[model samples]
Target: MYAGCFLVLSLISFTIQTETAVYIQHRMGWNKAYCMLYFTHGSWSLLWPMQLLILRLQKWNVPWQPFWRRHVAILRSTAQMIQHRTLHLTPRQSQQSPLRYMIWTTAYVTCALTVAGGSWYVAVDMTTASDLTAIYNCSAFFAYVFSIPLLHEKVRFGKVLAVAVAIAGVLVVAYGGKAEESTPKHGGKSGGGAGGPDHDAKEPQNRALGNIVIGIGSVLYGFYEVLYKKVACPPDGCSPGRGMLFANTFGSMIGFFTLCVLWIPLPILHFTGLEKFELPTGDTAKMLLVSVLANATFSGSFLILISLTSPVLSSVAALLTIFIVALVDVMLPGDLATPLSGNAIAGGCLIIAAFIMLSVATYREMDEERRQKEMEVAESEVDEDEA
Candidate 1:
């Protein structure tokens, strides 16, 4: 239930974020991609605080000191689980500080995320939007591949087939439509925080190069997702609330790193005039705020979803956004709406079908794991009695 809610939240916010990014760059003429990325990522820092407020409100009857202490302990214990990648810990391990490990992990993980995300901007001008969409979304396939070794996920035929179908759907949506004459290109901001393509940009100077770069980015993005699952997510059998809390806490750590370390590039970019620093005002500022908040919401929900489910599932679920975005475009007023192609209808159905198959498979996997654990527990109790 929580997983479904998070998925919906992520899909909605991601669509809104994508559209606002386009508006901010094209309509408002604020083309600072890095700045937008910085602000949105930094907003993650608010998650923990917001969570704390909600938690406190829930326990309003409790004494302040006790509530605060309990909150600190919960965070510390969850941090330990993340650092060690398990819920069980030895006395020595529990006593040792998880702070250093967490800080280092958060730093490197955020670095990976930034690079993977930045690739969108770097390649957007160098490739067709069709290529960008198709290639980047291929991260869903890579996520499943990486999960085999990194996550110890068994190579099940059902999962492989589902992933294949999902990718096919994406291809259909991207390339199945009949070709039309290319529109005249305009000089505008080429990428946004999420690294979306600037469709209005000139033709690619080097299609081959852009494809290769974005391809690397796609692999890296998948690796990042699996890595987070391995390093940050709580071990199996953890309660949903605990998983959600820790997910937001870890998200805040990412946000904190972005604010403290990633800001260094802003100055360098400004000095080099690669992207001069300029603040948004008027409607631009209003819309930018909305976009940033929406992104924060999406990021938080996405993290929680990954913690609750497998990265492969989360990545495949994200593909739903492509169809949703198309639907949104169709709803836009005047010239903004892109006509819904037959390919989109066909592709969207395939993607949905794939998601249903994968979801059933995942549920069965979880049930089997649960029963196996129960058996192990029963066997352990028998052995203790015999002793």
Candidate 2:
């Protein structure tokens, strides 16, 4: 039940993020509000909400332990029980393997760092929120690539080809959307005009940069997904939930550090004697507040969704974001519409098709496993009864 809710919430969060990004671009002209919001509020708001959810589970009697503890307990007990029934084994045989733990811990930390750093970098570099959101939609490509080797999972050749087709589609969408240049408008001298009042607004340059940064970030994020699945639980005895909790906690910490470092360079580079930092206007503050809340919801739900579903599913659901954003854009007056080209439509369909194939494969695998388990139990029962 929780998993189902998490998946639904995750889908909703992506949709909301798309809508919010569009709103920010339409209202704030991409430069002033979008970049700042991504740097400051994006990770911070997400941390607390997710933390609260994890803590709530604990309060409701969920057992939480470090990866080592739970796995060691299982290995120790299994070895002891086996030894009692047969020949006694050496102390080393009874103990949990340290090398395996070390390898997994390293992978987890590396994944966390990559994801946190990439997220921060993209947020800092991306000029427009829509481009950032769109780039993230391509994360499924990375997820599929990493899943095979990292998670020891096999995908069908058809599904692989479908994913490739989806990538082609994404390329089409990225190339089709062209940005236009506009002059930056300044509102009197009440607030700081750090870039100067007449700083020419180069929308095309910013959009292109934003798209590139976001696309790279999505790839890095996909690698993180594989790391999480592999190290999240060990057969020797770690709980997947506990591993996820630690990784997320550590990832959030890294995000905070990255945010601070990114912001440090920006403040120092402010134009001299143009306009110093001032309190935000009433409307700006209100907008920031709403964005923060929406961002938090999106972030918290995303983590929960990832925990509940595979990275591929999460990635597929994210593809829906573009459609949601399109709806929002059409409803709003004076918003620019990038005409749907043949490539864009084809890419969208390919992505959707890939997701369907992946889902069918997953379901088939699960059913087969369940049947095998049942057969094993039935065979054991028959042998016992005959004896």
**Cα error of candidate 2 at position 128, Å:** 12
Structure candidate 2, residue pairs in collision: 71-237, 169-347
Model 2, 1-387: lDDT tens digits are: 554565566456545544444344445544443244334333543564476466656565645464346544644443342233223446665564444544445445444534433453334333543344345545677788888887666777755675665555555444444411221111000011011112224344565665566566677667666565454322312244543454344335434544654454345435552223443456655654554555445544555455555666665655544444444444555545434445445656765676667667666776887799899999999999999
- The superposed Cα distance between candidate 1 and the true structure at residue 280, in angstroms, equals 0.8
Most lDDT-accurate candidate: 1
lDDT of 1 by residue, 1-387 (tens): 999999999889888887787777766778787888789888889899999999989999999999999888888888887777678887987898989988888988898888877777777667876677778878888889999999999999889999999989988886767412222111111123343335426566788898898898888888888989988888877889999999999999999999999999999999999889999999999999888888888889989999999999998898887788778878989976778889988998889988988998999999998899999999999999999
* C-alpha RMSD (angstroms) for model 2: 9.0
lDDT of 1 at 63: 99
Could you estimate the TM-score for every candidate?
A: 0.93, 0.61
Q: What TM-score does structure 2 among the candidates reach?
A: 0.61
Q: How far is 241's C-alpha from truth in model 1 (Å)?
A: 1.1
Clashing pairs in 1: none
